[model samples]
Target: MRLRQLLLAITLVFTVAISPIQTDAILAEDMAIIVEVEGDPNKWKAYIEDYHPFVEVIHVYDTLLNALALKGKSKDLYDIDKEDFVRTIHPAQKYEVPNAAHSPSPIKPPKRNVNTPYTGKGVKVGVIDTGMDYSHPDLKRNYKGGYDVVDFDDQPMETLPTEGMPTLHGTHVSGIIAANGEMKGVAPNADLYAYRALGPGGVGSSVGIVAALEKAVEDGMDIINLSLGNSVNSPDWPTSIAVNKAIEMGVAVVIANGNAGPDNWTVASPATSVKALSVGASITEIKIPYLTIPLEDRKLPLQMLVGSPEWNFSKPYQLVNGGLGKEALPDVQGKIVIFKRGEIPFSEKVQVAEKAGAVGVIIYNNEEGVFQGGLTETTSIPVAAMTKEDGEWLLQKGKEKWAYTSYQLVKDKLAPFSSKGPVVANWDIKPEIIAPGVEIASTVPGGYQELQGTSMASPYVAGVLALIKEAHPDWGPNKLKAAVLSTAKPFKNETGSLYQPIEQGMGAIQTEKSINPEILIYESRLTFGKINEGVKEKKVDIVVENRSEETKKFRFDYPHHESGVVWDIPQTFYVKPKEKKHITVGLRVNSRKLEKGLHQGWLTLYNGNDEVYLPYLFVNETADYPKIDGVELTLSPFEQDKFKYSMYLPDGAEQLTIDLYEPESLRYVKTIVEDEEVKPGMHEGIINRGEFVENSYLVFVKIRNGKTYDSFVTEFQNFPLQP
Candidate 1:
């Protein structure tokens, strides 16, 4: 789910050989970039500045990352990249801050239900996103000094609308962590620092993010919250590595898993950073809208989209298919309009429907599961989203629906939009925890606003971490993370099936329990990775630390029965007071006897009656996921009149080909490349220059695996060369 938006065109500095970290094409025009070096960045910067007059050295990050941020033409950078000292030339990536749609007005912030023992007194929390509105009453008290990488200034302020897309995201996130005025956050007394890495429109690049991280560490930040991320899902990405280094330096990092939800492998960096605490979206107790038919068993559970009013109509209204809700319709007064979600924004669809005199709106999923969406503009009537199944059923049945009307509280449910994970290269359970992200009311620039996404959920956990840090000032970052994970509460879905660890990780945070756990466990969950047919067993070790003065006894609880799985359990044992001991757990599996797919469950460890659940899973052979992703086109610099195309082939393709079609109409044009035998990993090539019959065409990548053949249609306008 890589979001496509118009990005800045700039010069790219790099070697002829490119790393997978780059997604955007290197243009001949001057652009900003980060040049990673194997040698000292300071020395590299000095040498570049002294020798290369064409290149502008922005910043040298030598401490945490040996990289030089620069602005120059791709040609000039390429010449410098010829030196062996340069590691990789990285294109400045557009990292977006995830925030659900927001309304023009503020919502009433919820009051704290219970008082906590610690309020993060004296702890320093750094917010790295769009700069905070320090002028806001709720945030001003805790607002500390910070630098602005976006505008290169000392004042880090949220941009005004005159600037790009005016932002309130960082302010909202900051309020969630430490707002102490009319609205009190989880750690209301903590010191807050703002790093405006993202500017107008909440958009930023990799260099700014890395620079911000370096500055935060220099300022001695105890904890850092990054609600920003890119769609590239790789653990080895520069940002992910940078986060890992920060954690190594004893800084706790909390990041939003992503907004691309319910999909496996959608967790983006640096949330994919193994050491950082990744958080997903979940819900607290709240009532949502539902639709029912008189005699039908299908009841559509609807999420009242943010920036829209509640659905108060209890009576059935006539339903009409709006055909994607992009165009106008006649004779639709007082009827409920149904829209299949795609192409247009939720706000636009709702606005169109509202303007057409529709009483209510239903924008159904373009994908499998239900989604949480927002309207930028508040609508006069209620609007909601349903699952693809229910939406299609309505398309067939075409029935007017009645509302549930009564209270049905959804508690501890995973937000449909929170990204899930078993990270690609090494299978790791991301979002090591979950928190309330649905309609969370927090501080905006002008006042309190309710915005949803893992963005809000991340700060909630960061505030929790602050409280934990205050309670145990002597603990390291890993210990703090372990305490939080071991003491969390796992949730079950409506079907009574516990949500998988990959979906909710250790589940929602338990504030009080995490701050003062009886015992702490490190290496929260065991990820066994992909187990092939021949492999019979796998072993993982977890460290448990006793916090009590007395020795603690622990025993392993049997996992639910799976035909081919056997446990190598340790006998009940006692751990010395305040001692940390390594405990081994083994999973012996007979692959032939078990079903050949993803097999997962939980193993419980008990100390007396209190229990700690550890999650483990492995795929047999390999999961049938897409083998290719992200096809991008750029003009070749070395060749004449040729377009350079790049794509990632995770598992090499048996066959790879590109097909061109007429844009909008989708009429077939011609083939660009048809390779019968394609290699694995990243693939790139320069297309042969040919004459074009048309000015523009859509580009598609057709790939083949064992039994699956899929075509990826991508939007590319006006490839100037041969069509």
Candidate 2:
């Protein structure tokens, strides 16, 4: 009885332990988000007016007609979360105001004159993103005809509701291509065609995005701006293939490098599609002085806290929760407030303390691993946070004297979360360039707000492409991609730096230099053909021609792996000054049943090294050809289960061939069903040998390929063979 009772207890304990875990596992798969808005824009405006320059609010509309009509006015009728707002009045025309109270650095824009000629004149740039606000002051003049592929509405172009739609993300992006004035775009005069694929939720299915690209291509868009993307895993995604086809047709495709952050090199889909020019995010640091908020008139330090180190000395203390309680105000008026990170929303944390009359609030991390949290557009008061340990220290310090310090939040080079990349899965040269993307002040759903991501980086490139396209109207998409890639500054990613060149791409796109350059231009397009599975030895053929007048000494370079690749000639090849030559590169795959996938590598060609290779040859080298490898695996099963297997033998492979099959007991059986010869990596095969076993079987294996092994016995197993 005792033994049975003990066993029952063990079983009950096991059941109880596993049941909760199983339930939790099921619950984890479900994801959801709930947002609560307590007040309207009018209520927020009274509070917003307290912050300076009214600079963060810029409305990016599809057309500038409305903004121009409004002339110069600062109204709260704008999307507070959006960037890239159209400028109703030029920066020079308006009086400079003080920067934001917590301003980091002065906003620095690329230098451009009103009369500067940019490339994209007659060309049309198709923007596929959230809807565009056609009435935006800066973007209106450049707005052309476009379609909304999402809902397919007749007036696909309508003024989206400010509160419900941040349809302005596309408009802000459009401005980057053509916004004029103190903030000059790469192509200020380029025509714009906008498409709304993503809706208010800031999300879209793969089908919608790809459909938009196809439509853009059909509409004769010279350049397509894809500032949004998901993680890249395979080359089979529809958008990926479509983008590749677009490049082949001479259409310049620019996409975002993704904002996944600080890692070595990460790549997002569409951008990873090899053919697209991937752009990364950079910050255009802008600094402004004279912006300050009054600490008295409104509510000086609405939140507050009180603590005494004399607690250890048995001092009586009272804990109280004053202020608005559940109302939208802070807590502990005029005193410091301490809060935890989880449970409550950060905005609510600030609000709770604000109503309490607390002058400051410090939030400590709730997650075991993290200790710091950044302030968002919601948080008010001189808010700061620290780790649990740091928070405790600050609490102790507060008991002595409250310290109120103003922090100047300047724009940094790159946001910590900005995605890094050397282009993962395969390090194909990506992030072809970088552009401003973090906390970028632009137009939003209602008015202006600071937003960041690769979404911002892409438009920067698009705008630049517009400039280049306008400058050289005759250049095709291939020429355009090359020009941008070649002109990019060679940059390397440091351990803890803001920009990682390989991941951020060729380097941040220098708006000024892309319009002009020195040396051989990148003007060629690289197209890859299918690589069959059976091919044991494949040859890659490429051509490098001189696009210059003088004899250009060229150096041949492509991604190298001694085991897989072998080039035809010496490292350096000279094109009779202006001659063109076809070079052949060979690759040998030494494996069988290889999986089908895309592989990419850079085939860099340069002439004379800077002072390093003067004596070798003063040849003006050519810069072009980023090579690619596209492998197509085709394996046809000969018999079946015995199709293929790899095992290393000490004696080495001599003659490999299936002899016969024998079954063992009632365990299982595996038949020598099918076998076939695989190319590139060769192996002997025995097909339809009629070798079959019901249960478990032993098969005699022989190798006939070489003279290493005469014969051997191998066992095969089966698991309810269906066919």
- Candidate topping lDDT: 1
The residue-by-residue lDDT of candidate 2 on 1-723, one tens digit each, is 011111111112101122233323423332111111223423333343454233231211211111211111112222222213222111000101011112222345443323445546787888887766666555567777777655554233423456343344575566566655444555767788877666653455454565566667767899999877764423334466668887787788888766555554345566777778877776565331111122312111111111100001112112222222244543355565666666655556766776667655556655433221333224345554445554444444444343433323344355444554443323345556677775455443333444456777787778777777777778777667656665565333335432333444455566666554433243222223334344355444555555566766666555445343333434776766556567665555432333343333344556666211000000011111111111111111111232223222222233344444544343333434233332222122323313443333565555433322345454544332233
Q: Model 2 TM-score? A: 0.53
lDDT of 1 by residue, 1-723 (tens): 000111234212111222222322453556555567887888988898888889888877777877777777766766776667777533345697744344545456755423677999989999999999999998999998787877666889997767856788999999999999888899999999999999876878776788889889888999999998887666766688889999999999999999888888888778989899999989886686667666666667777776677677766677889978788887778888889999888878888888889999998999887676666665788888888898998877765554333336787798888998877666788878999998788888777767788999999999988998988887778988998899998989999988999889988899888888879999968887777786488888999999899999999888777777888879697899999999888888887887766666788889999988888878777774445654556533434354556665666678888988888798988898888667765576767645334556677789887786877776554323322
Off by over 4 Å in 1: 1-7, 10-33, 47-56, 71-94, 99-106, 112-114, 328-334, 399-407, 635-644, 652-715
Where does model 2 exceed 4 Å of error?
Answer: 1-116, 154-167, 181-183, 284-346, 353-415, 422-427, 443-450, 492-501, 516-545, 554-571, 576-606, 609-723
The weakest ten consecutive residues by lDDT in model 2 span 611-620
Q: Which candidate ranks first by TM-score, i.e. highest?
A: 1
How high is the CA lDDT of each candidate model? Answer: 0.78, 0.47
